[model samples]
Target: MDDASSQSRPSADQPNPFSAVPIEITISVGKARPLIRDLLKLGKDAVLPLDKRVDDAVELYVGERLIARGELEELEGDQQGQLAVRLTEVADLQDGLG
Candidate 1:
């Protein structure tokens, strides 16, 4: 390899950059805010209501920034019953992770 090309490449000791790194994508189904008294009064099998319904689109976030919106779905096949999101509205990031 030429010296110029070798110099431009990342060394083995250096990190692989964000391309190979993993970032946690948080999926927010809904939010529920209960009073402190009501929060503490919860018991086993008790249900706390959320702002959204079962048919509502869930929000995806990377950190605090909202990334995309999608509907909740159950997987088929061996992964059946596993919950997933089908993105309906994705943000225009323009190369940004957020």
Candidate 2:
């Protein structure tokens, strides 16, 4: 067999194998689990507190996997008053499912 035969071609259905792939990334500030009764009782002004403090680093998740930890920041210039995450710690790819 030749080297050309060993390599596979891209299928017509997917022009680029990595193209059009979707990933969901979420930056979690904190988490809270309230009782059903408490949840129902919450009104407009009610505050649901999170487990994390204001200074704590937020977790960055790809779907349900924890990919990195970052600090929240305010974007300026072109981003103008928008919020963004500044990655402080990144998870190692070699780490087993961590």
Candidate 3:
């Protein structure tokens, strides 16, 4: 076989770099406190309270583990809001969820 034909042969042990990585993402959860009756009665100026406090850091859970905490903030230019997490420790890429 020629050099080109030899090189063209596929290797069995080669790893595919295009393989997708597994990543687990968790959003901050908050409870909305409003009765069904109250929810129906809500009109223009109705104010419903949440279970979490304003100063409290929002909890983020990846699968079953509590990964990190962060403060919610609204983006200036964009309409969508964002969360900035203060990472306590670097998550183990191999052991932990990607």
Candidate 4:
């Protein structure tokens, strides 16, 4: 006999209802910590140094969780070029969510 409750519950192969929900994905280029005094001294063209080099892979995050690594790219089109990240390495699902 088939179980009615089993049919109502989501199967392992089935897509989750939350999957359709929107999530904010962020690509972290780098990080910096400036003191209040230093931040206040910033000029119009002030440049703050980051921990990462230009060639370093950028971190992709979903909320606070690290998801993937990618390289920065420029989308060619209009007068103002749009910046984007090209995925290089994907995180393993078992490690977390890929």
Candidate 5:
């Protein structure tokens, strides 16, 4: 067998489709409202309210782009639960953007 032929083809021992893509899993996204410097003077237990309302759907972002919006839900036995995003709207938006 020639050196060129052996070099051009992959070996049998090599793994199939040998590449992995990295993905991030976001747990929760709430509107962040930073307290003013003067407000910090109040010290601990001082309530700094978030900009978003409880009924409002929280926006999910991947990198810098908006991905979806979901309502927060509590799972049984698990205090830290999942967000149920509206799939149809998200898919449509993603398709349109793409």
Candidate 6:
């Protein structure tokens, strides 16, 4: 009898069945550090300064592992004004995610 939970995965030579699986990619533009006293004094509109400038390439990560670096861009046409990433550097996945 075929066990539903024991189905075999596709061989390496076959098409990857998990290709459509979704993953969360985090974008790290920069970080800010503020004193606890200053943090407590925040009001309606607060602008925390980041270490990087607007043109700096942002780092992409899967969990804590850095995966790639890319520049921030705006979408055009139907997706106008939406944010997107233009990958500048990609990690060697064979080595690892970082």
Can you rank all candidates by lDDT, best first? 6, 1, 4, 2, 3, 5
3 against 6, candidate with superior lDDT: 6
TM-score of 1: 0.77
lDDT by residue (58-77, candidate 2, tens digit) is 99888777889999999999
Q: What are the models' TM-scores? A: 0.77, 0.74, 0.45, 0.73, 0.51, 0.83
Q: What is the TM-score (0 to 1) of candidate 3?
A: 0.45
User: Residue 10 deviation, candidate 3, in Å?
Assistant: 22
Tens-place lDDT digits, model 3, residues 11-60:
67864445467766685657796879989999998788888887676667
Q: How many residue pairs clash (N, CA or C atoms closer than 3 angstroms) in each of the candidate models, in the order given?
A: 0, 0, 0, 0, 0, 0
lDDT by residue (tens digit), candidate 1, 1-98: 56897776778888657668889999998999999999999999999999999899899999988889999999999999999999998988765334
Per-candidate local distance difference test: 0.89, 0.86, 0.66, 0.88, 0.59, 0.91
Model 1 local distance difference test score: 0.89
Colliding residue pairs in candidate 5: none
Global CA lDDT of candidate 3, please?
A: 0.66
Off by over 4 Å in 1: 1-16, 94-98
List the lowest-lDDT window of 10 residues for candidate 3.
89-98
Which prediction has more favorable lDDT, 3 or 4? 4
Q: Select the stronger candidate by lDDT from 2 and 3.
A: 2
Candidate 4 on 29-97: residue-level lDDT in tens?
999899989999999999999999999999999988888999988888683478888998888856964
Ranking by TM-score: 6, 1, 2, 4, 5, 3
Which of the two candidates, 2 or 5, achieves a greater TM-score against the reference? Answer: 2
lDDT at 54, model 4:
99
Stretch of 10 with least lDDT, candidate 6:
3-12
Task: Tell me the spans in candidate 5 whose CA falls farther than 4 Å from its real position.
Answer: 1-22, 25-29, 32-35, 77-88, 91-98
